[model samples]
Target chain A: SQTIHQWPATLVQPVGSPLSLECTVEGTSNPNLYWYRQAAGRGLQLLFYSVGIGQISSEVPQNLSASRPQDRQFILSSKKLLLSDSGFYLCAWISGGNTEAFFGQGTRLTVV
Target chain B: AQSVSQHNHHVILSEAASLELGCNYSYGGTVNLFWYVQYPGQHLQLLLKYFSGDPLVKGIKGFEAEFIKSKFSFNLRKPSVQWSDTAEYFCAVELYGGSQGNLIFGKGTKLSVKP
Candidate 1:
């Protein structure tokens, strides 16, 4: 069975502070990873997706960026956070040629 | 660019009430459809999915959705919803054979079933 782990389940940081949210998958290799944000009534929005290491495709332009350092490790980062950057961030992974995606317990970031 | 639209932003229903949540997409070609449920304080769970064949797909917890090609719709339905069914529901779409495999989602519909 595959499992995804997201760190610092909840965080409270002052505005303009640097941010780092990490996600990792176990029991799978070369899996496609994705980052999504869930806001109040806005649903889940795709932020970034990676097919392989060092390959990231951003879905929307925002104050965030993503990186795939390893085959199953994905990190979402922000140099300077904005008030609008506060939301529940989720990490998901799908095996190559697979349709269903598995999600991790999200990180609730509050930019105070 | 592809997108998904869920008709209701919120819905309130009493137990045993028949439930139907409308979902539509803005694409003309082949696509995969999905419905996810997120309970309070929990991660998203796959309620159902539509890949190919059998436009009507059944999912966990007695939930089902019908795919209408002509209308470009995939509406989730339940004969009698339980109070435990209260949760946020999301409709998502992925382009068939899309290289990037980006899954687009709609602004979810929050369902509140009262006992």
Candidate 2:
């Protein structure tokens, strides 16, 4: 069975602070990874998707970026946080060929 | 660009009641449809998906959905629902061979079932 793990289930930061969220998948290699944010009363917004290492696609333009340094590791980061950046962050993985994505627990982030 | 719509925003029902949630997509060509569930503290899980086969697909938790091409709807149904079925459900659509083939989710419908 495959499992996805995300760190710091909850976080709080001030505006202008840097941000980093970690996500790792176990039992799957070279999987397509994605980052999503669910805003209040809105649907999940795709922030980033990576097909392979050193490759990333930005779906929405914001103060955020994504990196896949390793095959099963994906990181979402920002040089500075904005209050609008506060939302529930989700990490997902796909089994390579257009498969349904599996999501992680999610991280609740608050920026003030 | 593609988008999804879930007609039900919130629904409240008692155990043993029938369940139905409406989902529709706006895309003319080929696409993949899906329904996902999110429990109180659990991650989102794939309840079911429809790519290119029979229109009706059964998923986990005794849930099933029918894809209607003419109506552009994929509504989920179950004869009876349990209290544990209380969760937020999402509708998604993936445009075939498009960049957004990943997923474009609907706002979501929150279902509350009482025992």
Candidate 3:
């Protein structure tokens, strides 16, 4: 069975501070990774997705960026956080040629 | 560009009531449709999906959805809903060979079932 791990489960950072959220998948290789944000009443919005290492496609332009450093490791980063950046961030993985996606326990980020 | 639309933003229903949540998509080519559920404090879980098969797809917890390509819609249904069914439901779409593994999601519908 594959599992996705995301941390920190909850984060509180001051405005203009740097932010880093990490997600890793175990028991799967070369899986498609994605970053999504769920804002209040906005539902889930895809931010970025990666097919392979060093290959990322951004869905929306925002203050955040995503990177796939390894086959199973994905990171979402922000050089400077904005108040609008606060939301519940989720990491998901899907196998190649598979339609169903598995999500990790999201990180609740609060940028004050 | 592709987009998904979920008709109801929120719905309240009594136990044993039927459910019919509407979902529509705007894409010219073949697309995959999906329904995901999220309980409070839980991660999003796949309820069901429609790729290529019989138009009607049944999922866990007595939920089903039918894909009507003619109307570009995939509507979720349940004959009887329980109070435990209260959760957020999302409709998503992925263009065949076009989405790049990204799924476009609709503004989810929050279903509150009263016991």
Winner on DockQ between 1 and 3 is: 3
Kindly list the per-residue Cα lDDT of model 1 for residues A1-112, writing each as its tens digit: 8999988899999999999999999998998999999999898899999999999999889999999999999999999999999999999996655578889999999999
Question: Which residue pairs clash within candidate 2?
Answer: none
Clashing residue pairs in candidate 3 are: none
TM value for model 1 = 0.98
Error of 3 at A55 (Å): 0.8
Candidate 3 error regions (>4 Å):
none
What local lDDT does model 1 show for residue A68?
Answer: 97
lDDT of 1 at B44: 91
Candidate 3 chain B: worst 10 consecutive residues by lDDT?
B94-103
Sorted into a CAPRI-style docking class, model 2 comes out as medium
Task: For model 1, state the Cα shift of residue A67 in Å.
Answer: 0.7
As for TM-score, the candidate ahead, 1 or 2, is 1
Report the error of model 1 at residue B84, Å: 0.7
Cα lDDT tens digits, model 3, A14-89, are: 9999999999999988899999999878889999999999999998999999999999999999999999999999
Candidate 1 C-alpha error for residue A89, in Å: 0.5
Worst 10 residues of 3 chain A by lDDT: A92-101
* TM-score, cand. 2 vs. native: 0.95
Query: How big an interface RMSD has model 2?
Result: 1.7
What ranges in model 1 sit over 4 Å off? none
lDDT tens per residue, model 1, B6-72: 9999999999999999999999899999999999888898999998899999999999999999999
